[model samples]
Target: MTTSSMKRSQPFRSLVNRLLDHGILPTRKLILLLAGGSVAAALGALAGLGYALFWLYNAFLLLASILDWRSMPRRGQVNVARILPEQTDIGRELTVSLVLENHSGQPVPYRLRDDLPFSFERPPDVAGVLSAKREIVTYVTKGSERGLYTFSHLYLRCQGRLGLWEKQAKLAYEQHIKVYPDLSTVRGYLQSLQESLIVDGKKFLLKTRSGTEFHAIREYVPDDDPRYINWSASARGRRLMTNEYRPEQGKVLTILLDCGRMMGVELDGRTKLDLSMEAALTLAAVALRQGDQVALLAYSHEIKTYVPPGRGLGHLHTLIEAVYDLQSDFVESNPLLALEYLHRQQKRRSLMVLFSDMENYLLEDQLGAYLWRLRRSHLLLLLSLADPLLHDWSRTAASNSRIAYVKALAQRFQLDRKAFQQKMTGAGIQVLDIPADQLTLTVVNSYLEIKSREAL
Candidate 1:
């Protein structure tokens, strides 16, 4: 949390009367009048007029402050509860709610300020009224980074009727909020796919092209093959319709996530792993919706987490949980270990996707061997990010010797990576090396193409 909270919660009286001792909150009209009366008393002491007036004025103002402070709601007469999100997507603004209940049966005005994490945007001042018995206040803030965030303290002040004194209290309600990489982009893609399927009138688990498996019936589209048309259903519906086929269930999809040192490198202000996370989610969600069993293995030097194969839209949640908290390790990754583990656990042929950084893979002598071994059984597809900075450096016209040398080096790396891609393709492994910014869309399209070709 950004702000330091008080060591212990003080009583409402101690908090409200704080302005009376060692503070300047009460130094307004009443204090000015008291100061004026004191000067008059000193000056008129010879005339014997303002002495009584000074004491009366001071006593009256003191009595008023005391009365206003005492009018505040006592302990147990007011209850406050905070509602925190279960987990928030990193860099997304989400609303936090507060339920303020007033048992004092009077209209109460309140000011609430939540102590948020340092990086998260602090919410604006939340002030409202409990018109009857309860009220709810909501404020939005964005979590600027991933990991666990906490909301430690609630600075609440209940105003008195006269507004002269406020009963301030620090409510200790620390909430542990998990900030995961933003998955909204992936979800949006998935939603789009689902909506398209509906518009095409295809069922979930749609089979692409020619297939023998029994699927549902749907309204015919212009591009649908005519051989699969159901004559009776078309006649009944009075429109041309086709028999939609669902592929034989259990087309296996395996995702191998690398949380290695290179994956931790920042691109476009976000780590490579973060972008890969979204791509992985998009693949898992879409494949699962298509009746494919989706599994994931997260690894760096060794296996960190593994989610077993499962199908259906609900299994997407399992894949998300398995990889959501994964952080990139600075150590070198061992895709060989992942291949070995999958070889033992997965006995069937599957479509495997490996997310990694290939910028310097050609320099690594042993990078291709692990994936080559996996390609013997699995349909291995290697996915990696293309740094936009490299494109800039490669195309930039160098004006001096230093920039010329830097551009030369950049071009060399780019050619090496291209050679590596050609070699991987020669080995029969599909390599989708794309810009980091376009990962979600490209990955989704590639997967659909694979399914469309019945390559599963």
Candidate 2:
């Protein structure tokens, strides 16, 4: 019977040995206690206090064994659930809720470190509460890139009352969040304009030759169409006047985002490329709502993402999904190559908005040649994000050597930017230098102004 019992216990002993090998067993603390007891026993023997040392050694061993046995079982398991926003806009603070639940019957104390995506992180000095189930809310400003992001892991550290050791685990849950471009300014502008137009008593008319959709008709003045003269209305009226109409549908606008090394310069809390992407998306959303087809292209050294021009609600989703994971490349962007790619992909003439910084020195020599070619095929509008910090530094009085150096650099860069704008404009290209905060609004307004003039 004793041999059979030993054979059965062999597997259990092996399992415990494996656990000890992984440091999951409290071997170090137990070993330290035993070593202390041995030292005490030796010192007591030298001092002729053998009985006292023997009792002390046994008591130390008993305490260490009991503590190790108590620590063998895990305290509890923690599960976390994250509630994220369905859709968020750029430059806006969005709130995400996290709920942590303790699964053990015994009360468990845990500290949590929520893992946010690279673009989003909790502000400093944030803390989570301890409870069976507690909700922790945090906020992050949406980035300019439009796309879906998955945040899945929650890093946790739990410890018992002893506090000498901790159990670490990663509690994971999947969440999909969609980020949309900043469109509040554009939407507000469009709605205000529409309201103004309605209030002005300027009849909404659709031109058959221009737009795809038909708007209401009004009395014609000079050069009225003879064919459009309503015979029945003429019979009822004293004189005949032709009916006039304006185009109801808007034009197609495509925004090409340059995700290249030049665009990777940091402005505010994000990259310049990201600001441009947000501006492009805002323009796209406004155009879509105004009954126009919108498309997007994210290109660096190569074409990253592309969404074909289309109208309606579905197109928004299609465009957002396409440009979400766009990262800037270290290599210089080939404008000639990008334009050529676009020309081949897009057969129709489009109002192409390009969001990229033009370094004057580089462009005056190389990119100038490509700009002339690009302008010939498409109605091109160039928009770039101006670094606000540089602008501030340029205006501030230099107080010290470091400040003077920074101001000098800022002035030089500003001069280069201004010179580039002039050269581009001289080439018959329209340009807009917008600050990060005002990028979306400025781009939207530019598009609206272009539409008002029927430039496209």
Candidate 3:
């Protein structure tokens, strides 16, 4: 190894420290042997040379034990240091490493365990020999929820020269880390948006208006902007020709995130709450970039957090901070209560996009009144994370009665969801039911289309 690397590997504890780590059994054994020698000496006076030789034998054994103990490790400190990553994702596992240096000029054996904080999965015991150099030991922990956690100290134990004695030391280490929601999803989308719009692709973002304002001419659709349709172009193409409208901006967008018990259900290695957070963050990033004021409200039975309407790219950080440490509550959400609280905070009309489960709101009639009230005050896009397991069941071959029954049950759930969507749409509400993986794409596209159509 390199000289620098060699210097880093040192024993975690000294021989004297090792004695404290484990009992000094070798010394005690030697003392017992000495006591045996005393017994032999007493026998020698009563018997003869045979008993005298027994005493000498005892003395030899005692001396051997002492020599063996002396040969063991006895006098150096365990040079140890700790390392940590800058950040870790919420609900993901991370490794914490300890670098041990052997400063005793010899090999050192050690058993190490770190004092881990609550909510971490205790790492397995680390045991190995520090070969007259530096070595690293690591343990993994999964943060069940979110927020920050700390690692403070470690306990290291090693054996002495003799088999009976050992030493231990508590090495102080300080580290701080945060477990955050998966922000990469929003970051990737923002990169795509930047490349296509803000940097050098302004042409891709600007749309031709179809109104008397007279924007660029393009194929037409049934809309209010078509006051000046070109009759000559229509004749040449034999189709309706109209102008597309300029992109809309300066609207309010709000996300209602459900953090009730049903959101705790796991999908694709993440909880439904995680999927909802990912979708909400991506949408917020897009809306903020479009100059729309964005707000967030996390709710279960009551309001968890409410961020008032804000705009600009910098506001995305505020949205992330508001929801980064959010988790699901073991109770059904009160959407009516959430609505009442939101109205109290801001009465301005906004685009309200809700991320929740359809199962949580099956009682359509009881919720219809509250939902309609919100719909009156704001445009609603109620999105749910689709259950792929039910879709899989729908496509599977039902060879047996049990299999058929399962398929039937899956069909019923899908039908109920469809009925619920129809009911909402009939009341002029927008609903999107899609898988978690498709949420980012679908929500962004829908918002863009709504803006282009000037629906909100």
CA lDDT for candidate 1: 0.78
In model 3, which regions exceed 4 Å deviation?
1-76, 79-81, 91-111, 116-145, 159-165, 172-174, 193-248, 395-405
> Number of the top candidate by lDDT?
1
For model 1, give the 10-residue run with minimal summed lDDT: 197-206
* lDDT computed for candidate 2: 0.67
The reply for model 1, stretches above 4 Å from the true place, is 1-61, 105-107, 129-131, 147-152, 162-164, 174-180, 189-207, 211-248
TM-scores for all candidates: the values are 0.78, 0.64, 0.69
lDDT of 3 by residue, 1-456 (tens): 898765665454355455554434433545676667767776876676666667577767867666655655553556778888867777678887889887667676677888777877787888888886788888788776666778888777765554444455666787877777877666665677342433222223333351123346667677634666777788899987865445556689889999999899999778999888887887888788767899999999989999999989899988877888788998888777777787788788888888888887775356777888777788888889899999999888999999999999999999999988898899999888898877777777777767777777
Between candidates 1 and 3, name the one with more favorable TM-score. Answer: 1
Which of 2 and 3 is ahead in lDDT?
Answer: 3
Residue 262 accuracy (lDDT) in model 1: 89
lDDT of 1 by residue, 1-456 (tens): 323344344465576656432222432445566677767667668677657756776677678778867777776677778899889898888889988889987777777788888979986789877666877889999887777778887877776666665666767788888887788765664667443432123233333644557778989999788999999999999998898765566699999898989899988688999899987887787888777899999999889999999988888877776777789997988777777899999999999888988853564577688778777788988888997887899999999999999899999888888888899999988887799767766776777767766677
Q: Write candidate 2's Cα lDDT for 307-378 as tens digits.
A: 888997568768766875577889877656667788888877778998887552245366666767777767
Error of 1 at 350 (Å): 1.5
Evaluate model 2: give its TM-score. 0.64
TM-score of 1: 0.78
lDDT of each: 0.78, 0.67, 0.76
